[model samples]
Target: MKLDESALAATTNDLTREVDARGVADLIEFRMDQADDPLEQLAAYDGELPIIATNRARWFGGKASDTGRLDDLFSASRYDAVEFVDIELETVRAKEWLAHEFRENDVQLIISHHDFEETPDRDVLDAIIEQCAEFGDVAKVAVFPQNQGDTLTLLEAVNDATNRGIDVAGISMGEIGSHTRVIGHLYGSKLGYAPLLADDNDYAPGQIPLEKLASLIELTKNERVDGQVIDTIRSEVSVPKELTLSD
Candidate 1:
């Protein structure tokens, strides 16, 4: 299904974690760069959760080598379990060939931006998100926030983008801005990602533990509303299991 509403995703490199993530996260992000036998795992996947395939490049803060990385992701994106694919906005915009290929595979896209240094100002954030929205089905921006103000700026950008009807996910990394991952969904951030495995926090800093995030989403499930920011609410998030490929 389309990422048309608020949802949480468990970010992991292990396919086995998918079953455990059910009833909590709406999606499982399979990190091909980190997984051993990634394609072999994909071919064997019989789990319940739908997958969001990601083979992050080294330039994008991932361990994957530059050579054949896109080719690997290309192969991953076509798997039966994968419904969404996360590609860097830079990569897609540079050639945009992958974006077109993903479309032909009948998979949705999440064009993401990452700022490992610090969060950009509102205008730059908006511009990046807007450009991503133009290139794919969802626009995702993940940045390291130096302080509370930086987190606030990211939130405002998420709110503005959501009100403008863009499917987006806003993540403020590190301990300082970790709260945004949970509260972002309340502001119409279409996706919230949490640690899927025990050591997964190294890849995604300051992430809420998967189970805790699930509880938080469950507690606030009734508070989910539509088309508003902050004080408003969104409807209940989709049941994660319901989106499984087996269905």
Candidate 2:
């Protein structure tokens, strides 16, 4: 429920199979916008894992439309299993009033921003994260990077925000920036999202399979303790950030 540093969540449209990933996932991120009958599925959900309800909008790389999207998220907050609710940073900016409702309900908010094209500059990224911090419990940024350099820009923003005491989740989407997803955790990112099954279409580019990602995170952390230089491990190992537990 409370997203702490290094917490990994599985993102899925199908909640029925969520129990299949119980041991691996800290929580299940229900992609409400992608589901055919989201509310119905929620009513039937009795999975062991806690839920982070997200009803993403079409304008922000999801299928859900504007109509009743916010209403649905509000409804989801009432679910006993749901501990976190994700709202697009753009949506929050447009509908400032929703912040009051979330606060009144005492629902934890994950304010997210996505850049499908390219990771923004450090200044822009910092500003976006600052704005997100003001509106929600956690500031989450997902960016598409053209090259490794772009990932650094994202990491820089993450570092800056975290250093300033902001709760943040930074993800560099796509192949070029995949490493940032794993590496960002070292910089104090509070959350990482992955898919429950391998071979499933990734919600974002460069997402590492859940099983591999978890192993890599462990390997790297142990390596850090074993006196292996993290710089070397990072350069040689192609670790990704987003999770997917594939068979």
Candidate 3:
């Protein structure tokens, strides 16, 4: 599935409420690691929303702890509904075998890394983006921002990566850095993630509801109708695959 010119939101639950409410073309994230029976859930999911599977590891603030986590991820990619799979940069760098396996499966990979502590310096962030770009279809980085400067740093990284023709999703976590979600898209971020349910059960810090984010992005794009803002927003919302699954 292609990820271009459309808003793809996230759904934590196995339901399709978020996708329906926001009128988004895709669901950018489904935290498989958090599910009791991830494979079963995937198998039973007949909802009209394409999924981007993510079984993040504990090192990356995810609940997956089994030694065979990577193996499970590789298997999940085989599911026809899974258009994109998020693999941590650490795993991609350490496990060359898994990297090749993803390539062999013809599954799109999103090499991601999260820093819950603090955002890195400009050069450091750039280097990380470069490394992830080498291996995955999209290079994603989520960093915690201590202050406004840290948020700006993330914007710079997102802009720089997109300027260099790299597909990137950059965000700053935490209360102080929440606005990065909207601004990131303006700065050329290819994707944004919002909760399926806008309640307190969201997986990420400072995440807004899918509908709100879609509205905000639309408003921002409308305000800046010139340049590639409209195209970028459109790209962020398009779904590469059909949402329905046949039995």
Candidate 4:
């Protein structure tokens, strides 16, 4: 299923809940590296949210080893439910053949880069994003913020990309940069990831619980509307058990 970046941001659930609280996520990024049996879990998922699968390598802040990593990813892409798959640009750049495989499968690709240390200069950031965009539908960059300025740089990158008609998800890690998670959409970020639970450590650097993040995104979006903000009415919808892979 196709996804709306803003709407998806508002309806995300980090942890298991009795009801599917968050309406829909921009895209549910299932960190396959953390799942013991990712394929099995995907096969059994009864949620309405579309998935963006990632099996990151340890070298790139993921637990999965190099061996079998691509194989597992290829298997997951075949699932009807997965809308996109996050693949590191480094990997695609080295193995150009992998990009061809993704294209043949008709899977939407997110070329991603994670910098745990510090943000880079605007020129450097532009170069990285440009390179990644050449290989995927969207380009994502996450950087560790050393100060508030770093966060501004991230926003600038997002804005620049958006103006260029490029879909980008740019985030700055660390406390001061946390606000970027909410404001990212304003700058044309196509995806925002937050855990279902506050303490869930699935992602590194910066993360807020799904509920809190959803609330914030809603408020921000509402504030942008010219009229008075009204309480968002909740809807009752059953979660689907399986998602069919599509072209």
Please state the error at residue 107 of candidate 1 in Å: 0.6
Better model by TM-score: candidate 2 vs candidate 4: 2
TM-score ranking, best first: 2, 1, 3, 4
- Which candidate leads in lDDT? 1
Off by over 4 Å in 4: 1-4, 7-24, 224-247
- lDDT of each candidate versus the true structure: 0.87, 0.86, 0.80, 0.77
Runs off by more than 4 Å, candidate 3: 15-22, 198-200, 224-247
Give the range of the ten consecutive residues with the poorest summed lDDT in model 1: 230-239
For candidate 1, write residues 1-247 as lDDT tens digits: 7776787888888897687888888899888888899999999999989899988988988878989888888888888789998899999989877789878888889999999999998999999999999999999999999989999999999999999999989999999998888788888899988877474446777888889987877677666565566324334444577577675
Q: Write the per-residue lDDT of candidate 4 for residues 1-247, one digit (tens) a residue.
A: 5434643432121313313444634557777787667878777766665677789999898889889999999988888777788899899999978888976777889899989889999999998999888998889999889999989999999899889988788888778789999899999988887765533455766677777888888888885663333333223444468966576
Q: For model 3, where is the 10-residue window of minimal lDDT? A: 16-25
lDDT of 2 by residue, 81-143 (tens): 888889989989989998888767767889999999988888899999999999999999999
Q: Using Cα atoms with residue i matched to residue i, what is each candidate's TM-score against the true structure?
A: 0.87, 0.88, 0.85, 0.83
Error of 1 at 137 (Å): 0.4
Model 2 regions lying over 4 Å from their true place: 224-247
Candidate 1 whole-model C-alpha lDDT, 0 to 1: 0.87
lDDT for 110 in candidate 3 is 86
